[model samples]
Target: MSVTKTSPTTNTDASLLADHEVESTYRSVNNVQLHIVTAGDPDAPLVILLHGHPDFWYGWRDQISPLVEAGFRVVVPDQRGCNLSEAPDGVDAYRLSELSADVCELIHSEGQESAHVIGHDFGGFVAWNVALRQPSIVDRLGILNVPHPTVYRDTLKSSPQQIARSWYVWFYQVPKLPEWMLRRNGMDNMVASLEVTSNSGTFDEETIERYRAAWQHTGVHPRINWYRGFRRSGSPSRNTVTQPTLICWGTEDIALLPSMAEKSVDYCENGQLRMFPNASHWVHHEREEVTEELLRHLSQNSLS
Candidate 1:
């Protein structure tokens, strides 16, 4: 549980970090070291924000300040293989079980029995698994734009529409081609993909450049390995989530269908789903109310 403070890198905005009083630190969790940025008080209720694929800790920049103002100790991590975090070799290393363990160990490292866990895209996949595999470590669950693993797996098998939209998942199974495509032209494809997938103006030039810096810094292989590892990760034995869950979805998501969001709620004992018709896959950025919803969800039965 060793934690070391680190200086801000090119991928991070020093002024924004200073404005929010965000502290960057590295913690040895599971078998790898993860770069995490935390804000707010040390003793406040812990809220862990996990970013999705092709993204790092900066994805949650919009929510951190609001959460901190709401009296939460917000910890956003560049989950393994994304930004400054350690990228372990091999596809097997990125398995869902391994990903879930990292979150659990992170909670323990923070000296908390459980924390409010929130995630988006690939991050949501990890968050769902954390609640399913280790329910005790998650006080509440917040998901954005990703379905439950079982729902997604089952849908891919049964729904033609979902299968069609998820063609990239299979393409990523290829050894090096996918990585090369993502890295070529200074990662122009990766940058374009983000813009095309989200609402207009959701990703401006400055924000896109930050993501470009992170992708160039870490390369795309380790991140693509998450998709490659998915085929090998297999499904979890238990699919139901026991914790109070809040699922926020953007109806215009290009990858995941909104119907999957409805099915995902079926797997939760106590879950609420809010759909943003105007927003795209990046609901947190496009909609201001999402932060309010998340704050309300996390404030329920506050541990403080």
Candidate 2:
């Protein structure tokens, strides 16, 4: 599904996770190599985290230790076109359906019939769509930011608030300029916007540099093509989520207004929302502690 989110003030190939060390491995899905990071025992209930654009598996660095310590094996993949993952040419290569299929294949590789999922930004987009496509594999869902595409489209048409907040989606629709600007300007704007969008400046000097590295990776055109593909694909097929869902939103997010956030719960059959008044688009990072609590809640709820 396509999302009308703000475009990165920049996108590049800069590393974002500096303080923590990440172990990497590969899993083949859809005839492409998927770079994934696994932490904890292979026998534990798998928790898969997905990162959005200009970010990588390291996006979950802060949550990895806590999640593993909680007795859940955590997995974070660099999706098909981002980071070390295979960057196959073509917009269709990164479609919502294809993204879901990749996760499905990854789960099967770990010898599991189903897995719990948590995604941020574009990764959340993939998570939501995957739940719809393969409810059998989605045990529970935790989403940070990244609204329902249906609500997003309706908001774009009706709510001037969401429209004003999402001016960057249109900017990204431009060809060549975004790539050139990101390479020339670096990720200062993207990082700054991320900081500004969130209540806290998690996108500090250090964090911004890391995001720049991922955005600037080779074949970034196909990576950026994710946004272009969505715009061209338009609204995707909406499927009711059979899995329980926990959605966390930051009221301070500049891209998605709180009203749109409040009104979007009907899409899930079993859904809950946790609001972070001071958080922004990257609520997961801004309120990592609180988001983890919600994850624990999801774990327990699913077990019951």
TM-score per model over all chains: 0.95, 0.87
| Candidate lDDT (C-alpha), each | 0.88, 0.73
For residues 1-304, could you state the per-residue lDDT of candidate 1 as single tens digits? 2222233345463344546388888899999998898888988899999998888898898999999999999888888887778888888988989998999999888989999999999999999999999999999999999999999999999999999999999999988899889978979999988988898899988888778877765578888889888788867778899999999999999988999999999999999999999789999999999999999999985844
Clashes of each: 0, 15
Q: How far out, in Å, is residue 295 in model 1?
A: 0.5
Best by lDDT: 1
| lDDT by residue for model 2 (1-304), tens | 2222234444322133332344577888878887788877789888899998667887777887777777788888988777667777777877787888899999999999998988888898888877877788988888888777677777899987778777877877788987666556555665655566666557666666656656555435666778877776534455467688888887777777777666667788888888888777777777766656655765694467
Q: Using alpha carbons, what is the TM-score of model 2?
A: 0.87
Off by over 4 Å in 2: 1-22, 234-238, 301-303
- Which candidate has the top score in TM-score? 1
As a whole number from 0 to 100, the lDDT of residue 287 in candidate 2 is: 78
User: Worst ten-residue run, lDDT, model 2?
Assistant: 11-20
